[model samples]
Target chain A: MIKARVTVTLKNGVLDPQGKAIENSLGSLGFKGVGSVRQGKVFDVSLDVKDEATAKHDIESMCEKLLANTVIEDYQVEIV
Target chain B: MIKARVTVTLKNGVLDPQGKAIENSLGSLGFKGVGSVRQGKVFDVSLDVKDEATAKHDIESMCEKLLANTVIEDYQVEIV
Candidate 1:
């Protein structure tokens, strides 16, 4: 068994409302030093593949197909 | 300047619909080895501060105040 981890985040040019909301919430809670917040997603996946090559191939397809929205988000994958 | 990174994830009990959808998408893409996906969040924050102690304190405050929902998500912070 292998572990495939993927992280997805909004592209640099995209607006992140969820992150902004969190930033606003922080100010109200008295954390005055915060300037901004950017939110991203992480996925820890378990795979039952036999070798590294197959694992990489499958994971890449997974990321491209479902783990990220190519239009607005970017993704990175790590195998362990 | 110091860098603070925070990772937030749903507690073990919460349902992760985004992850589930990704898993299904992977299966349809012909990557049958995938079993489960647990989704999490990551935040990279930059702060102008001195000393590890103060940075830790402020980062903790940020996590508790805005980075995590507390009710459904847990968080961890790294200072660099």
Candidate 2:
């Protein structure tokens, strides 16, 4: 089996209200020096495939097709 | 400035409905050889602090106080 991780994050120009909320909350909690908190999603996937190259390719396709919304988000896939 | 990435994932034995949904969807999309899929959260945080040690300590506190639920999830912090 091939193990992989996919991280999906909002595009730079996209607005992230959730991240903003976290930033504000952190300030209220007295954690000083915090700035620009961007939240994203991570997926840990175990594939039945055995090779690294094929695992990477399949995971990328998964990101494009279902894992990420290409219009507003960007995704990175890594085989571990 | 110090930049860090925090990854929070559900601990073993926790049920992840969203992950199950994604796994099923991937199967429907005809991406074969897929196994268990676990979903998690990632935070890309930039701190105004200059040192890595202090940054790591503060980020850990943030994770404990807000970023993660200690009862059901585990978190890893990395300085980048």
Alpha-carbon TM-score of each model against the true structure: 0.83, 0.98
Model 2 residue B18 distance off true place after TM-score fit, in angstroms = 0.8
lDDT, candidate 2, A1-80, per-residue tens: 88999999999989999999999999999989998899999999999987899899999989999999999999999888
**Candidate 1 on B1-80: residue-level lDDT in tens?**
67777888799979999888877877777778788888899986666667767878898877776678999999888875
The two-chain DockQ for each candidate, comma-separated, is 0.66, 0.92
**lDDT tens string, model 2, B10-76?**
9999999999999999999999999989999999999998799999999999999999999999999
Candidate No. with top DockQ: 2
Model 1 regions more than 4 Å off: B70-72
Q: What is the TM-score of chain B in candidate 2?
A: 0.97
Clashes of each: 0, 0
Worst 10 residues of 2 chain A by lDDT: A49-58
TM-score of 1: 0.83
Error of 1 at B37 (Å): 0.7
